[model samples]
Target: MNNKVITKEAAAELIRDNSTICTVGMTLVSASESILSSIEKRFLDTDSPRNLTLVHAAGQSDRNRGIQHLAHPGLVKRIIGSHWGLAPKWMEMISGNQVEAYCLPQGQMVHLYSAMAAGLPGRLSPVGLNTFIDPRIEGGKMNSCTKENIVEVVKFKDKEYIFYPSIPLDTLIIRGTSADPKGNLTTDEEAMKLEVLPAVLAAKRFGARVIAQVKYLVEGGSLDPKSVVVPGDFIDNIVICDNPERDHRQTSSWYYDPAYCGKIRVSPQQETSKAPLDIRKIIGRRAVDFIKPGAIINLGTGIPNDVIGQIVKEKEMESDVTITVESGIYGGLQSGGIDFGIGRNLSAMISHQDQMLYYNGAGVDITYMGAGELDRNGNVNATRLGSQCTGAGGFIDITQNARHVVFCSTFTTKGLEIELNDGKLNIVKEGHIKKLVNTVNQISYSGKLAVEKSQKMHFVTERAVFEMTDKGIMLIEIAPGIDLEKDILQLMEFKPLISEKLKTMPMNIFTA
Candidate 1:
């Protein structure tokens, strides 16, 4: 194996048309942006690949950089990964029938690629059983409207397991801090401790090419052998990016710094809008009823984003409460403030993975997430709604591990009318449709698992609040100004069991 270094352009040329490529990175972190830009430039300069299949545990860099330049405009045909939100262009491509997008479970995706790298037949896990990802539902179905690949139930020793096939890789693109002339690499500080080494090894074992983008090229024997993550023996080409700015905080070798923000800079514009209360705000405020003092909470994007505002306004809990994001950021009170605060003293910045590992270990006492569609069986589909589907992001990990989970959204979207006057929400016009459905197109997180784990779960909307019980979804409360029969009952796909002690949510939530 030669330890030769090349230009980023040369590395891009190694990727041929119609090849299966695996990108190494999680959302917004450790993506090889320089290499991705080079690929985009190459595609623009020459004939682009057709029917290219991208395989990865997550589409971190490809979606953000590659999709806009090459992958989305019909240049690429197939995408197999866990989530799709990081790349807006790729989502559009999938929706337009220009590409085939297959969604896989997060943990299962990691296991699948690891399995392939190890020369295994496939991966067997209990993650996707009884959900839409189940093969029985759609055989991991993929279409313009749907993205999930079905999970198959295989009974071994009378114990059921979901089987996910191993997918071989033709090329692996990874980013690291530095590479020795001998090709030894290190990712000691990278975000997720991603299986980049195994991915590169998988490609190498299959006689495929491995391309690595690094900030610098060191002497042949410069890098400590023990510190090397992917040795030169496995790497085929090394591209020197030279831009230390891009490499420093991204490679994960550097200590997590408060000054280093990602490509998307935190700005006031991106902050969740705060104004007069609407149906969404009403639902968010009502979710506060579930919060307890001294609880650690994780807030998902969307309606749940509004909960922080309500919490701050209400001052409902003691000062011991903590709030976190799914990205693994913690102690950041993000209550529609001028800037999202972080840590004590409102530090507003923290290491990303630290938050993920915390939630992964079920450190969060409660979690609030937004949902697109939910069923009587308590399955929630927040990933895809109509023509819009955001990646699961950290929804699965947060909801699965949180002690209590709350799904917050309006009873129906699209022209739903509700107004706030005198600090109270008044439903003027109920949206003529229901967001709660008989079945969800995809199950982003399993409510059954929440029940089995004895975790409390609630589906809270402007119209009603339903709790998952041993029997099923039970109506626990309705909003202050909602009509129980006309608004809540008629809109639900299935009849919700009304609790004998159902009550109206408090209007003066700030005082509650």
Candidate 2:
């Protein structure tokens, strides 16, 4: 039998210069770190495989590791991915115009892998019609260096749709927990099943090399057929990484957690504590109220993810509703910080591609997302922040089709401080930056489109809450101690319509 196993260095040698490499990873959960490091080392030593284009569906870095290993200027010439906030190196390169960067919706980017696997020209959908992904606005280009138009506005049957053309793939870097002698891969110990199958298929269908990174290799027939995720016939090379502590981690911080991979089940009650009541908790407590019993929900990063998941667990609502992460985790205690994509005690796990498709189909009843900025027109900018371009991950796709969207954010940012006394919120120091701006730098969520679809929307903050109306964004709720005119209106760039019967935010939300 021909041996598919090879050294990580040998696997790195397989990649050619100027080739397009697609990887499957959600941060460091399923990251091929050993192989990626080997490739980076090879590039640094020989500079043989230079000017490569890297593609991924989700943010694949924990700021320093994962894809950041290949962020050198000459090593990567272009990057086509969903998120960049985790990888500051790529952000620096993109900001410096050293590479061509295109930021597509995370869902669309995942589906594009399937499109490439199917040998389709491109994917046509209405997911990114009016947002920044629309060619009429920016065409998903992150900088002036990005010149090619990969996304185009097309009309099908009298309706408009965004078409994302598939790029030719040359190499696929994917990870699994184990590999059999015949090269079948299984992710039984990984945090979540990423888009590995599609990435392999996309590479093999296009005659590209498939590099598989596994924690260990099993004997022939030792692996169950049902457990195999990627068959050996498609994998060109296998690189075994034995170090789970540093190289192969369940998540960035977690070396290995049985609960994260469903090897064992743990109750949410065991994982959480009574979190201190703060601005985040206040927003999360208020946002949790929007979640109706039995509603299917998607929670974005930051306040929504960090606080709301804890609130749900604290409230013991795990069985009451289904929560999904874009990383393909179904239901469990969703993690926060660098371990955002993974969860423990998951109900189910699917491919990221399939999960994105589910979200694009409007499978979510309501979605709670964080916002970077909000304009008077009700447009939300979660992409560009200051001079840095943190591409829209799955925010565009998740929010666009959800029946209802509740944006959880702070009224102000950059050193905003508050104190909770009794049931009142006292702003000690106002934030230097106003989140409510006159015009957002870029529109991640279109208000005009939301109004047209009649999607119910709400903006929840520590001090104020606003709801989207046909006329405009209307102030509906204010914190108990906040002055409507002095605290809220004066901080925003434009005046918001006030509801005649505006009420104080539930006092319970302010309590610890």
Top candidate on lDDT is: 2
Q: lDDT of all predictions, in order shown? A: 0.66, 0.89
| Model 2 spans with C-alpha error above 4 angstroms | 267-269
Clashing pairs in 2: none
lDDT of 2 by residue, 383-425 (tens): 9888788889999999999999999999999999999898999
Instruction: At residue 431, give the lDDT of candidate 1.
Output: 74
How would you encode candidate 1's per-residue C-alpha lDDT over 169-228 as one tens digit per residue? 788888776788767887644443455666776677677888888766777777877768
Model 1 compared with the native: what TM-score?
Answer: 0.77
Model 1 residue 32 CA deviation in Å: 2.2
How many pairs of residues collide in model 1? 13
TM-score result, candidate 2: 0.98
Location of the lowest summed lDDT over 10 successive residues in candidate 1: 336-345
